[model samples]
Target: MAITKDTFKHVDYLWDDEKAKALGDDQVALLLYRSNILGADLRITNYGGGNTSCKTIEKDPLTKEDTEIMWIKGSGGDIGTLKRSGLAGLYMDKLLALKNVYRGLEFEDEMVALFNHCIYDLDSKAPSIDTPLHAVLPFKHIDHLHPDAAIAIAAAKDGEKITNELFEGQIAWVPWQRPGFDLALQLDKALKANPGIRGIMLGGHGLFTWGDTAYECYINSLEVIDKASQYLEDNYGKDRPVFGGQKVASLPEDERREQASIIAPHLRGLASSYNRMVGHFSDDERVLEFINSNDLEKLAPLGTSCPDHFLRTKIRPLVLEIAPDTDLSDMTEVKAYLEKEFEDYRQYYTKYYEDHKRDNSPGIRDSNPVVILWPGVGMFSYAKNKQTARVASEFYTNAINVMKGAEAVSSYVSLPLQEAFDIEYWLLEEAKLQRMPKEQPLSRKVAFVTGGAGGIGKAIADKLAQEGACVFITDINKDNLDTALATYGKDTGSGALMDVTKMEDIEKALKAACLKFGGVDIIVNCAGLAISKPIAQTTEKDWDILQSVLVKGQFAVSKVAVAILRAQDKGGDIVNIASKNALVSGPNNVGYGTAKAAQVHMSRLLAAELGPDKIRVNVVNPDAVIEGSKIWEGEWAKGRAKAYGITVEELPAFYAKRTIMNEIISVDDIANGVFAFVGGHLSKSTGNILNVDGGVAAAFVR
Candidate 1:
């Protein structure tokens, strides 16, 4: 990849022209300050990874006098090469009003008011989403970036030591924070906490510093990143690891359009929901090679460049390991892969936020990574425009390299899941959310559940039915379906009897469900049999029955169900009931556990295969669910009781006490886990294992 001259030369122009541009006069100096600071801001980090702004008094045509407004960059303009037209004006008074007043305002509302009140013209590009930070900063010029070198050192084990030695006491350190409003608020609090600070090192992020002049701000970024880069060159790996591989070309135009068509719907949903345009493309060869890599596990670390970048990049990019023997031109397969990938991203966000936030305000800025990597194709970054995409690419490239270096020294530790969530969804983070618009991608959705008689299946069925969805509750046992109808039947809800393992039965049942509800929005495969026995003692008959119940049952139902869901045009959601044993091997009960494990993989494969149709598949791994079901009282449960050397009555207690917190795992808890996934709240989630196990058998108790 060739580095363009515009990338470096344009930024350095300020060094020569600064003195010529402004000799004095405060307003002219401020403009010069902004121009110089912004030039360095762009080069300090990657393209769109940094921002610079100047707050000054300008005459308001409507007010007919001098009024304060913030001249911030638009969403996609690169800070380093930012032109005069790139700046979006924001009302300084409106921002000042929101500075200390924190309640009764939503994320999008604040953003809208800030943008609308301050912008010079409505036709111009909206103010940068980082407007809040500028609003809060007291400096005449502000510069911030995810500097590659600085973060590399700051993320290390000896980061504090190195950071202390590098700048002495000039820099104040901020722990990693999800960007947006919460980050702005945190910086505000930090300033209050420490009276005088010229620079801030955001752990795991990059660097933030401001000065009275643009030159100072620009110098600060270069000096800091250069210092850290030199330190890394000296202390890190002396021998550079070779990235030997074939350089792949960009996707052809037709292929690009095909890719766009497949992902456009979901992209639109994301854009509408977040109120941020989601312009994206997969053009990079390295990203494509990475996505198309043979190893799935290795792809986990290729997330966003920084925590805040997740808003654009998502948690991780999709891996496109297209098999040689497979149909390469199948756009359906491509679509399936993308949808499935998005679903899991949503699940991760939900689980991350669940146990972390103690307060229930808009807690982390929801940052989902937007990059996609195709095995044979190149990697792609998503942004509102070309500039933002370039920024994402640059930051991600540097971050990935640093991560490689860190891995060589010692493993890079991720923030605790809950703590990560706290930053991602904090009240202060809600500012970004407010800027978004309302979206209903799965609107007019209707769903049906098989084996909606008891336990996990019934819980999922009931929740969807309550969420304005027309639901069909089915069971092989007529009595159970009858009972379900009696309990839940309402305007659009109904019930029926069908054996999901039987194809004819599933076909007939789905026909009835569609006829009654007009179409299906989702499918929940909740039907399966449980018979636990050791592999050594297991008979061929037992294995057959178990596989028949778990795998065949799901296959039979989904085959016809997918057709109906596709016709509806609205995307569908699928939830499968899996056990904790599926994740960790089950003890002794090889027959049941093995079959269940296969069921999990089956869901995953289905997710990968069915995603293009906008149908998502996910598995719910519940541990020790013992409510509203005969499984708890069946002979199988009694046998397990004997194996554990406890009576059937004491078994629940045994499982409950096994967790670190000694919290009992209930049916409702499992239900809630399923509910979060099935709800539009997790629209981008699928092909994931959600453990609703209440801290089950953790190696260490916190």
Candidate 2:
């Protein structure tokens, strides 16, 4: 495979002179472009799995002298979307000096002190662990990535041989070494021995390439990777062994998603610690193809293709065998199986840690499995937050690709379990963990908000997410749901189109919430309907619509949610968004008032019934919350304003003056009342009513 201009044509270099100049600094601009290009391809770098650096000369403001500085990717930032702040500036001389004086210091202590003391900019974040490797390299631009094509070769039994054959002495090969001072020194030695080497392959780790310019470094990486890809294609692209014996043929899409929904909550519960776990299910062609393969049990448990993945996905994924005809409704059996599986996993992990952990290494990570492989369905990745779960999902997806590719050409292999353990408990990773914020009040709680696409429901969902609860929202309007998800962010909240009156819709939404997040810890029934009419003028259709949603809808959602909570053997919360009209009926508001009154009473009855299970039921009766309220907009607001002898624009002021506090209620005020109950602040107070009506004397509840 000769290197040509079109050899790496698949990559987009994004080379516009005007656009590049606008980025302020030419080197910074080129580095950003190169990082994005490399990260754009998942085969190159998955999520935050790679780093890049550039060495440049800058004049120090204080010293009034030219200084050589190294700009490397900082911790906790994704390479695909890296910006100026994502790269930390370090004085190159100070970074390289640590190698001589730090011979006896612990790796963690030396690295931390070096990073803290050596600075080109005091405000910039700490540089990546690979900064030293970059510092010692003799190139101006450097890129280190775990591309799948290259990893296929590096993780093979004859990886060094294959690398030599492909690169023909153009690149040096370094055997697997836990990345730190030692690995940096080893790489420096390799480069020094082979002065003409353009790149280096770290067996079972990744690939590194360098050049005097960003384009040269990036293209060299691509060319080297292309060679490896070509080698696999020529050797194994044809007559590959097809792993047979799939337990069951793929199910219909709806059934697959339903199965995913049913199993998600159980997995989440198993994965949760202090923070409830969120799950991301993927049945992408690659994932499904891998899961459905006959060699799944053989390949998945072998280990992750790269050591970096051990941090996100442990060495092995938990594989659960679910028959095609298994009953998902009977969670009793499923729950039992998961609990036993988790116990066994815990014992195994403890023993594994005991066997491999170094004296000063951090304690074993949470024993819960991050990746779960379900036969006949797909895979589920669990983490405390959605972003981490999504990243794990991507890692598994890439792992499948790399492993399959490796097996196609030769046998697939990974680093030894000891090596994986070393990386998993590395002090560099521990430092990153220390920087995360403390868990929030509702960190482990999951909340479902009905009518969450609009004013009050959206507000409640957003607030719950802000407090660290993984929120699942439902609304009848698909457009509104999409818009709300777009605004609130898909990671914080997921939207489901649901008509609460329909039993199937209600069940499906609940299942989705369970699957996406774990079982619900909090339920806020914000879905409601209003019709103002005298008792005689209230048509059956009008009355039933309000009754079905405001009364029946709350009952249906709560029934399913409570069952999930009970199954988890955890106490839960249920807050109904009732109305002040439930206490003080306005003129010609018979239907709305009657239904809301029934809802309030029903909540009290549920409280009494569920109290033994530690499920608290309460009502927040908010009146005249017109601002940003879909319920109070348009015809409803106009009619209510007319009832008050005022125009629509004056309705809020009119209601405000009517209340003792002269304050118009807002959606956030109503949300706060709901949180007060669901957040366990009102733990002992159930079957109670909280008012956000600004002291409506007639509607006051003692």
Candidate 3:
């Protein structure tokens, strides 16, 4: 669709005259409206990729005098979700004076300090790097963005000529220059020379449009973008390739999951620095088409489609030579192949950086690849956190689309290497990168919680997430799993239906976790069952049910998880939720007690076997944790209460008073003990049992 004055009319403008008056600041309201409009359309601007500003009058904090202020989108804030706080207010007079100070400023750091000092409100967020351009542009409102359509024209070889023709005399052109005081001055000079120009297109970068009001500025941006879109449609519509191509057969879902389960951990190990990296897979049709293309080798490595993307994804992605049918089971071979590829990529990137390094160039970033294109399989994005991985995935996906569009229209070209280095090293961009909160202790760590729908398992998953771990929770009951996921938030915790009694279901869940969060670093075997009855009354079916869920199920899940953890070669934790019944069986609890006993023994044995591989296995034996515990609700609570000679309502107090400490064991209490084991709080202790029984003498193993 061609952008017109009414192109975005369908979008809900959150701010109208009534709301603007209610807000008491029409400029800020209009700025919010314009930012949301631009941000709403990915074709106009993607996440964290655009800035908007307005000139208004506000009372100065220091002088208490009305002064002209420039309110612009703050650093690191997404425009679509921009709030009043997201826009920093600066004294226009003080900001415009930075042009004089720019004459002496040699370092970007000094300019940043100067910009920070110009804030009209000290409590406001830092202003955008393009503050100078916005301040000098003379318009009451301004919008700057890296719209895909505009980028297609800007990054082309004949971009200047095409842009001139498309906009006629309505727009001016700025040659490629790193955004700074100098670029701002150049833009001001160009606009002054051409008094009638409505916008400016920066070669190899983005577009800028402005007007007297927010609506006019927004409409001008749309109109410019629409022209570019129309040009591409007219010229390249026939040449653009269809979405589907050679019907490359895909592996069965089961087989693909198995393969991803194995390969993801290996990739995680190869990409890890001091901390393990997480992986995110994309089977997006665009990604698949790019990877499966005959020209992938030629097209994939030719730098990012836009310079702004360099900050998130670097210049290019690394393409691994693995296919869907490749054997990822041989960890040693896979590791070696990946290490070699990484080394080669490092050498090539280092040489490229050195060749293009300028006096002001940012130094080289880590050699690790952010986006990895695996032939025959979908692409993967790696990062120290899931959010970063998702961001890289998005930018790379956009880069692929832009390149494909450019190739279809004409030849695909990118900004010069030197320009990319400028952006990568640009102090403003670098500061934005550094401003992200420090990685938490378990920032990139992934944890899997079986039986996580409720009870102690749910608590354990919540604790893991609190410590910065991405948690994948599973339960046989899909409804319970859904509820737990909703409470924890789908972003922080994902869920899958898993019946521990079924080995195939166990494998499928493990693979799903691996594919979802790259790999698992910690596994909590919390799935269990209880069948309380006298040995004579307990049928064979009851014994099998308890044994299959508590004993055999734990064994199956642990075995598969340990294989992945070993491939990761990273030290991992396994915390099995045993029970106090294992140490001291209650009356008629033969099956449940025996199953819990087997779990404790299995944990100890696995600890011994996996110790050499740095995998720690430990057990948290919780007793009478009746509060918020699904295990102790309904019939189980009634049965246990009957055994204790008390009503169901009094069962918790009865169990609490039975212990010497007279403390009620809670799910959080058990979760805390498990945390001590999994968080490496007891790093040196393994094959050990932690008791959360509130001083139950009968449960004391030592």
lDDT of 2 by residue, 1-702 (tens): 644555464333444456656766678778988898788888778899878989889998889999998888987777889988888899888888887666642544467657766788776777777777778887899989888888888887788887887889887899987767678888999998988988999987799998888777877777777777777767653655444335457677788888887777677767774345767888787787778878887887788858768678888888887674578878888888988887787787788899999988987778878898887787899887777888898998878767866776667888788878877887777878988888777876788999998899999998888888888999999998898898766667886999999989989889888767656788999998677767787899998899999999999999988877776666789999999999996987888999999999999999999999989999999999888899976667866877777798888898999899999899999888888887757788899999899999998775
**TM-score for every candidate vs. truth?**
0.44, 0.94, 0.92
Those runs of model 1 whose alpha carbons end farther than 4 Å from true positions after fitting are 1-43, 46-48, 55-138, 178-198, 239-302, 320-370, 374-377, 380-395, 398-402, 405-702
RMSD of candidates 1 onward, in order: 22.3, 2.6, 3.1
Candidate 3 RMSD to the correct structure: 3.1
Residues 196-254, model 1: lDDT tens digits: 77777777677778877765665565666666666655654454321222333445645
Regions more than 4 Å wrong, model 2: 1-18, 104-109, 236-248, 273-275, 683-685
lDDT of 3 by residue, 443-516 (tens): 88899999998788999999999998999999988888888898875447887999988888887888888888
- Per-candidate Cα lDDT values, in order, are 0.62, 0.82, 0.80
Query: What is the lDDT, from 0 to 100, of the residue 349 in candidate 1?
Result: 58
lDDT of 1 at 177: 58
Candidate 1 or 3, higher lDDT? 3
The whole-model C-alpha lDDT of candidate 2 against the native structure comes to 0.82
